[model samples]
Target: MQPYFMPYLGYFQLARSCDQFVFLDDVNFIRRGFINRNRILLDGKPFAFSLPVIRASQNRPINRHSFAGAMELFLEQLRHTYRRAPFYGPVFRLVESLCLEPDMNVARKAAASVAAVFAYLGLPLNYSFASSHPAEGLGGECRILDICRRFDATAYHNAPGGRHLYDVAAFRAAGVCLRFVKGSFPAYGQPGAETFVPGLSIIDVLMNNAPERVSRMLDDYVLEHA
Candidate 1:
């Protein structure tokens, strides 16, 4: 699916639940979508963190977009916002290393940063780029089906919002099972008595809890047949 901004725990759950996770970077419609922004809580208030993108032709690979000019500003914002977090030091160091590494491929850099974070937290999954695949004109359900076929996936899993867009009948006709992710809140080790904010970015959890605690939080989500 499309890359979302440091997406929620459920997104990682979906990634781990599948065999091969595809990043739909080639899709053009959701330019301003979560790929570059995510929500975080600071001083008990909700806020969004985003990255500035350099302009490029539509045909340019998402992995090629650059964040050169805004790197320092973005790092400063993250440091200022998350400095008080319980896991701030370690997370900040990781972010610092990734952001400063010499790389003009902005999309790849971001993807690598995300992968590194997930890896640090012990979530393992094979990630692939949709642009690398031989997709010509697939869209909507057809696109999902194409991925399923390419990966030999008998089941196609997606987030809850997918129910509104996925054609279940068509998938059934193609012999692929459709499934939706059901988020189980208040996963083990989540902060006690705190007002739960559902669907915030994973950074919220990382900042509020330790790595082991976050691992327990993974248990809170389940995949259900759609």
Candidate 2:
């Protein structure tokens, strides 16, 4: 999957399910996609937050994009939104580091953000950037198969949405297992809201729940063959 900015719980669940995670950073950027933006809870409703990308275009791959200076705005927004949240201090520090890190390339920053969360929970991440392993001139499933072969990965796990894009029989024919993650995001309390707002960034989860509690939530998913 392409690296997403502080992605939703389902993203983490999918990552956790994999033995090796590969970011599709070489793919063309989707202008309105979650690659650089995601929602967060603010004022009892879901608020979208984004990193400004310099010269973002579908013609350019995600790794080629650089983030413009706007993380401070995002950090302030998080501070205001989750100030009263239960696990505010440490979570804020984590967010601060994620945003203020030296890396400004869109793909690397997003990848590091996910890595930071895994580190906070003491989970090991064995991940790579797709561009680094150049499957040049290949596209779609063919490119994915090449990646699997490079890693000697017997199984390729993806989010539930991937079921539509991949064929179980074809992958099986390639000596690979095709599986999809069905994420169960158990509802947790959020400040200033009685009705739960689901699918916000992982930052919201960390803010409202302790790292240990959030670690348990990572396992709240099921895997099935696609």
Candidate 3:
């Protein structure tokens, strides 16, 4: 899966369920996508925050994309939005550090943020970049198969959205079993919100809830045969 910019709870659930996770850094950057943007709860509503890419081309891969946004400005937004959150102090620092990182590439920055959050949550899943291993394949499914083969993986797990993209027999032919993960993101309290917003970033989750609660949320998912 592509590394996302402060992705939602489902992303963390996928990471937790996997033995090793791969971030697809070699793929083209999809503008206005989760790669550079995510929803964060703000004043009882879901609001989007984004990292602007510096003169990026759609043809360029995620590893080649550079950020053109101000870290202070972004941090200020987070500071005000999550001020009342229980874990704001720690999460704010982590988020600030990620935004101020020297690396400009979207993938590297996103990977750094994910790693930081995993550490904070004590998640033990191993993660790597797909670009680190040069791959040969065309379509999405073929490319995914190549990744599975590279890891000598006996099984592959993907988010439920890709259920149609893969076939059971095709993966079996490649010596891999395929499965889809669908998480039941139960509604949780957000400090300032009257009603809960389901798809806010993992940061939002951490800020408002205890680590134990968030860890339980990571386990609130079902894996289906693909």
- Which pairs, if any, clash in model 3? none
Give the least accurate 10-residue stretch of model 1, judged by summed lDDT.
187-196
Badly placed stretches (over 4 Å) of model 3 are: none
Alpha-carbon deviation at 196 in model 2, angstroms: 0.4
lDDT of 1 by residue, 150-184 (tens): 88888988888878998789889888999987776
Model 1 whole-model lDDT (C-alpha atoms) = 0.71
Give all TM-scores, in the order shown.
0.85, 0.97, 0.95
Which numbered prediction scores highest in lDDT against the true structure? 2
RMSD per candidate (Å) reads 3.0, 0.9, 1.3
lDDT of 2 by residue, 119-204 (tens): 99999888999998997699999999999999998999999887888877879999999988998888899988769988899998
Error of 2 at 204 (Å): 0.8
Off by over 4 Å in 1: 56-64, 104-106, 187-196
Whichever of 1 and 3 has more lDDT, that candidate is 3
Candidate 2 C-alpha error for residue 73, in Å: 1.4
Q: What is candidate 3's local distance difference test score?
A: 0.85
lDDT of 2 at 50: 77
For residue 162, model 2's alpha carbon misses the true position, in angstroms, by: 1.2
